[model samples]
Target chain A: MNTLIFRTIAPFLAALMLVFSVFVLLRGHNEPGGGFIGGLIAASAFAIQGLAQGVSAVRRALKMDPLGIAAIGLLLSALAGFLPFLGAMPFMTGLWIDLNLVADTVPVSSVMLFDIGVYLVVAGTVTAIALALEEKETD
Target chain B: MASTAAVSPALLEQAMSIAPVPPEHWLIVAPVLVPLAGGAALIALRHRPGAGRALVGRLSILLLALTLAANIGLFLMVVEKGALTMVMGRWLPPFGIAFTADRLGAAFSLSAAAIALLAAIFTRGEAGTGAPAYGPEPFHLLLLAGVSGAFLTGDIFNLYVWFEVLLIASFGLLALGPDRAELDGALKYGFLNLAGTTLFLVAVGLVYGVTGTLNMADLAMRLPAMEGVPAVTLAALFLFAFSMKAAAFPVQFWLPAAYHTPRASTAALFAALLTKVGVYAMLRVLVMLMPAPLEELSLLIAAIAAATMLFGGLGVLAERDLRRLPGFVLISGIGTMLAGIALHSPGGATGAIFYGLQSMALMLALYLALFEAARLAGTPDLMKGGGLYARHPLFSGLVLALFFAAAGLPPFSGFWPKALIVKAALDIGAWWLAGAVLLSGFFLTVGLARAYMLAFWHPQRPPAPVGRGPQTGQAALSARPQKLALTTILPLAVAALAVIGFGLFPERLLQLSGDAASGLADPAAYVGSVFPGAKP
Candidate 1:
């Protein structure tokens, strides 16, 4: 499982998957992909890196504890739900803001923020579990 | 296109009927959201050096206090305004997730929050300064959130989600200890509860398939009118699933086996709140949502209730472990509440709700008392322990009061609910149910008296040299008296006061319980609250 070819390609594969995950997360507002699926993809990427470079390397790369990341994601999602309170609206109400860029308009919404939070939560939790399992294997 | 046209008029009417929510309505959700947000924040701070156990415990206490206040406010508002409903994201009923608070939900949520706050304070005395990576505070808050959500949610599917939330948190709390017994207990608890909730989910799916709505109020309205929908079978499935969760009758094996394995604070919280939530769900569904099926199945439920009462009482008498005794007491109390449900009258429902509330506080206090008693004696074994009153008279008195309450003796909180239930049973000509209730109470008293005599009154005897091991001798010798902490004493005192207060002057609770029962017996206001202009 730890062959030279596999080890060499894993980092690049993980990087590509992480990028693809973000793409899926961003496009989820009006498309087939969303935070849950994106998070799964990112979690798989972390698992791949853990398998290739070891759990310690992945932990060091993340710089934050995976559970901390999950916690922050939960906070972000909850805050997103609270955003409508400023406008005297009920909880979890979506408020959209369209950004006028140099060449195009990009629409951002609290719903999108919520999706990103969900993605981070899923990715972080899965990575934490996977890393723990992998470390147990090494032990 | 034809279908769209066909649905457009009703959709438009529903959309137009959506009213702007008042600012005060947020209180209904605050009990749930505050804990979730606080829990997440606590977890986020888990790795920080400054976030020690003391800090986390204080934060948890503050958070739970806030939730309890919110619940009280919500309860008051519901009492004043009748049932209150808040649909998420301004969606109409039958499509949106609804948080509806009637007398029963509001009162139960208030009790849940109060018990949670007390449990949080109890944990402060037990928590050490060294903080684990995942402390119990966050999970505690998350568990409260789940419970409050379960109590308040009007959507059946949302209730399932809340159950899962609490179940996950409970599993985390159950396995937090390093002992193998904790893990073993958690496995059994987790497996049985998961099976219960899975059945519940399947039933919910079938309900939606049949009735085409997950909103409880809408189901209540539609279920009776719908013909050839197997409503009785669906009701039976619901009762079976909830009965499993409630640890009633034959399905109750998991509770006593697992509840005693957790640390005392966690165990007390579970004893106080978990099965009560199951009972609350049962009452809400069977009584309010599907009355016809409940009437049809009253006999079966009564049989189950009687068996649960007898078995739980007998288990209490035969149990040796002090920690496990409270679990059986809890099960026995649940049986009494089920008898109330079986009576299927407003009086019966009132008795059930009142008994449930009393049991929640009593069970929490009882478990905490047992934990302290075990610590004082240096062992949890009933036969090996004695002479608690000789050392801590005040504490022993408190434990006695809680036991009397558990036994449904006179001049305690437990007596009033028993009287209410027995009277309701007699009124309905359920002589056997009334007999079961009285007989179970007697059994419980005897069981508890034997426990109290062995653990608190009887003189501590020297260990027998021949059969008793040296470890037992050492344990008895090493029983150094420890001073009870103020944090521990305060919660126990508050619980005792509540039991006595409610016992002496039960008129208020009786009236509140009666209102809750009436609301269940006729859910016109409950449905009307959810859909403002909908016909009952």
Candidate 2:
């Protein structure tokens, strides 16, 4: 499957795809983008690499296991719920921060961060579990 | 611990004084944190595979043991201290995390914890052999997280979040046993329940819109002050949402189709807790927090409850699959409990509480017993068993007792709760309703008897015996003992004893639940328990 042209291009493209997925995840809270879409993009990147090289190749490329990513994302989201507890508020009340940027207000919040964590989790968990099951079917 | 998380003065003022702040809330909370922390630690230590899995298992067992012990401790504390409530982070009443420990909550928690503990033990036993390897601790941890979250969360929105927690964890559990049939169940379970959850979320949003506060105590406080437009709408949303969760009437197909596929222990655990969480939330928010909703649409709910009971009981009678029968019976019992709740009188409501507790314990006990019998008898095919009463006498005896408990036979806890529900309904001038409630018990008993007759006494056409017939055990290849290990034996024993003991000793539970019902009826008591300094 790894023809000469595909072999050279796959890694570069997958890495680019993953980085772009993070961008979507980070921007999810304010704009239309977020973790779910981001995770799907990242998974797509691995799929592309899988197509060009092999399943094992994609699995190796993503070192952090998908299940772990999903779990951490879940924890990060839950921790977001607990953030208020730390700030002497009730559980799950949203917290915000603002940075005086050159053009925009550049608002940031723990919720948005939590979404990013969710994004990584969704991306990692779905892809890993799906791919792992597919490999099992083959066996 | 005193740095910044003090309960605000204004919030305390809102919670009028009467109830003592329940210290036992920490006992429940500690078991919950252990798994949450363990999940985090396991992820951090993922590089050490052996250590991680071992830690997860050991910690889960240890945590479950501790939680069981915690329930025991909390039970003692409840007897000593009355109902209990805990406010997380010491925020003011409306702004903090509230966890309560009334007798009702303790009863449910103790039952659920017992189920989880048994499931943990069974999983451990299965792990050593060639059976399906249990999923990582995070899965069970997430499962427990959902259970604890459901048990402890005091607000509506937080309940939604806990629903999501369990939803995600359920995805893992469903997928862990992935196959064509399992996936079929998973997809249906996910889509349907997610819809129920989303419906609940919408209601919470609407309740917040109407009440402007998500806190149960705050809602109770504001409910009296608020006007109509959205209150009825909020109530409607709550009914629709909780009905779906409890699998009331029309929305229950997802349960029977999906539940039988999981590993037996997992199925039993889900059987014990999932729908009850819905009941608990409904009891918390609708009955206690906003009394008007419980009274207003109760007749409609009663009708739905009646339908749920009849359909479920009949559904169980029709099923030949042994595992599937109990699933239907479990669904049927939901209707019975709802009937108790629907009578809309205090007596009726308390009856619902007792029956709800009794049935949950009995249904779980039934599943464990049935699973054992099915494995021993093999084929679980109702048509093919004969004289097993002579072969597996002890197992048969347990099955008979569980059937009696499930059927509400006298001297069993199930009977008293069943009797109370009827009495409660009758006290409310709903003689017809009382009759239906009584009939539900009798109907379920009929199904139980049918299953018993077919399972042990019915003579097979071929007259199969040990020497002449086909295989009649879990493994057709061999007559494996289908070992009833300590884990299996212990939880079942506890449930049986609870059924018999709680049945005869109804007065204690009644007294306990009366204090709880009083505390729950007055939301102020719940609020005051969390903030002892608050005055009426």
Candidate 3:
């Protein structure tokens, strides 16, 4: 049955979401992937968890509150945007400090940090909403 | 470590001479904080009996008061300064996150906050006794955050986030209500809005690709500077997204279906506040950001606006459901605002802002009145409710006042803004638009009259033992004004007084909206503040 396939494939899909979400979030600064897409992927993973299991089971497993995570993510993302200002750059202007790494120079900017903030937001918001609706239906 | 982006310390210091970022702009943070923290606190105290309601009520009131104070303070400050723009981080204008509070955004956000404040009071305890009331507290907070985000966000992509935030909150509110009507309406409303939001996201993505920047004021400057298909495509996307919100033309069926589904007071807030926020966004972007494309697409937009106004009014007239009538009326009013923009004059645009406020106030009052009438009649059917003056003189009288105010009779808050818009149309040689406004006004009059007749003038059918029905037409008026507590009455009173106050002194808000309009027209001040080194 389709439900069986969905169940069997869900864990793999969730694992893929975790990997892709992080990959997208990391590459957002100069590449195609970013916070929003990454967040969607994570939320999809939670949704699959709900679909594969049940709302109560998934809520117990997650433990953390998703909406709270979203709020914090927004705050963190906003904080990331404010980082460039200490140096008198504009809001959200990227700041890169070259670090000596294993082979070559590594650059980390505030925008990358901001992207992570967004990824957290997306994951938190979507998952929270999905879980709430699922729980409501069960009741 | 506190980085320049922590708060616009310098700007805040210069403006207020206080701790930077003025509490108002920072007040934007409260919605994000309160409910989330409150939700946690609630979860922690779930074992406690009779505790959550008091806590939630206190928190909701406290935060709403703070939001009110922020808006009032921000308005006073902006009035003193002529214009206000704050970039989130020290990031420059074109690239950084910017939040601007021109008079229009400030005023409307203030209006919406006022509506939510009263609505919160009316619905606060209605969620039913004990922990985990009706809709979740976190849900309400997100709704507040979403509205604040829309009002403050300066970029197109950011607007999408706000819309998503609003949608999610709305869905939660709708679904949590849990009734057949609410569920059916919620499913339709949710799916439609979700689809619209997805389209909006795609549009925002396309806009970023085309402009390489997402800040709205930045887009306003750069978009006009760009040319051809990409610009047109972005314009199309923006139109599609905003139109979905405005509920104009063919896309508006869901509003009528859903606006009446919630509890009457809840419906009042939705009818008054939510969709206008969309109209507000359209007013901001269409006029400021993509004016050139606006010109190219003016006729198309104008045609749609005309269709929205006329057709929506027809639907209102045809609808027998009193609750459903206001939904259509609100859409038609949006059509008028759109028409003003299409006329493309400062006067027209200014009228649009004022009329937008009028429509919201009128719709809220009307819904409040209609809800009472429905309760008295034991159903929402307009035909079922009649001859109530003897039974409830206070309710009947207030409903009549609300009807006139909504109908745009003179000496009420609703008339001035509309008169201004009509005057603007005449000034701009928009005879057709002017005519449509008048024609729509005529039809709206008839629609309200129908309610007046059904509820007040017509005889109520006689009750067998319980109440009356077909042809028995006698009435028992409730002796007093329906018992709206002080908090409930306060918003309605404030709104009614505004209608009267503005009717007397149209110039008070008029000058403010006009100043905001002028500030919007010149991109230099906004750009100069954000990107100090930009080519402006």
Candidate 4:
């Protein structure tokens, strides 16, 4: 039942999708891209891997429980939101830290961190579902 | 596209120049945020089972205690300072999400946390998240977060979000223990509640469309000047949605069918907190936000209240299963609250608030008592065994107290609120409503008394004549503590004590509930606090 072509190209396609997901995640703060979209892309990469190899293969590749990853993402986002409390601001207030990198000064915001957390949560949740479905179908 | 439109540059500039509001009050968000953070942390540790179970249980208790303390402090602050409003990320009212801690919201939040804390402690004793198959901590914490959010939110859309959070947690909790019947119950519970929430979303959308605002305070100000029909329809929609959630009349079939399927502790927590949140939302939105429409529909609401009470009382009479009887009792309690709402008097509303709190305590105590009684009787069916009064006087006493309190007997916590509601009904000249309340209480008492006779007083063996003790062996009081004594009996005793305490000193509760009712009756303070310069 294995397709040779799908097995051959799955890893490369997954790599490309993973990289593109990060691109979408990074620009989500000010642009149209977002954690949700980025996570979908990453989840699609895992879905492809699960399809090409198996559910077990995808689990081995992730090296962490999907639900656990989702939990971490949720915690990260909450921590990002709570960071403003230290500054005596309301919850979910955006905080920025400017980093100087040799020739350039870059600004990083907690909003972006929250976006990343969302991305991880979305990816983890969707991938978990996909793997479960695939595993169930096989059984 | 043809560029023929003349756009206003000033409008664009005005929109661009609006700055986000600076954060002024940091403490306002603690009710929702604390539980969210705790839930996340608990989920993170979900995979590691049993090893750190005790530590996690302690941490959960500590976290809930902190939340309760913080909520009580916030409630006091709100009462002292009017309303505490926080606009998320400094956005102004009607634009950014608003979290307001008014008298009603704060009191409900505090009570919710208190119930959750006690439930958590009781659950820990039963078998905390330490048990692999029972009591997932994250869901419980998330459910608390959602309930807190529902009370604290000042925006309707945000309330929907919080409902989802709680609903998801509840679904997990509902299906937690192993019972094949639970699947059927969970399905019904899930679908009906989902339909209710869906209706709520549609109502929210309609309300937003008409008033151009989702903020509760802003809507209160804007809604009156708008057309009446849509507002009334929206009110009806809210009534349907919230009434379904509260499991009142006609729509209440789901409660008895499903509530008893969960583990006893889980059912107790659900019985205590879930429907009350729905009733709280109804009191907040339907009565406070849309008072005119509710008044217009008072006769219809009163009719429904009567029917709900009748149906619930009949169900209790018809039920033979001991565990399922409390579910009907819960439905009957919902009807009593609805009857108060139907009266639309300040007295009626105050009675409703007081009754809501009393029901929260009594329902938990009743379910926990059922667990103890069943443990002693060796069956969930009351007809199978008897003479609990002779064998286990302490537990039988607890059950009697809870039953009397629930039946609205004199000098118990339930009596004062029922009296207030009855008086309010008579004052409003809704004699039928008053009759229904009394009749329902009568039926509840009769039914419970019969159950008590069958389960506790009547023995399979013939009773000894006159004042002699039964020959079912001596009343043995073991020096050693029995199993589940700490886990089960302690919480039930505490709840019984609270009921007694509420009865002894009803002043503080009455005063607080009166203040909450006053706030609900008049949204002026709430509106003014939210919109500083808006004309009434």
lDDT string for model 2 (B95-149, tens) is 6667666666666677666767766665654432212234544566667667676
lDDT of 1: 0.88
Clash numbers, per candidate = 0, 5, 25, 1
User: In model 4, what is the error at residue A77, expressed in angstroms?
Assistant: 1.8
Candidate 1, CAPRI quality class derived from DockQ: medium
Q: TM-score for the first chain of model 4?
A: 0.96
Per-residue alpha-carbon lDDT of model 3 for B306-382, expressed as tens digits?
A: 88888777876898877687787788887888887776778777877877776666777677667657656645677
TM-score of each: 0.95, 0.81, 0.78, 0.91
Select the stronger candidate by TM-score from 1 and 4.
1
Ten residues in sequence with the least summed lDDT for candidate 2 chain B: B125-134
> Considering every candidate listed, which one attains the maximal lDDT?
1
Compare the candidates by DockQ and give the number of the best one.
1
User: What are the runs in model 3 whose C-alpha is more than 4 Å off?
Assistant: A1-139, B1-50, B125-132, B463-484, B533-535
- Give the better candidate number (2 or 4) by TM-score: 4
Predicted candidate 2: what Cα RMSD to the true structure? 6.1
DockQ of 3: 0.16
Residue range with the least summed lDDT across 10 consecutive positions in model 2 chain A: A84-93
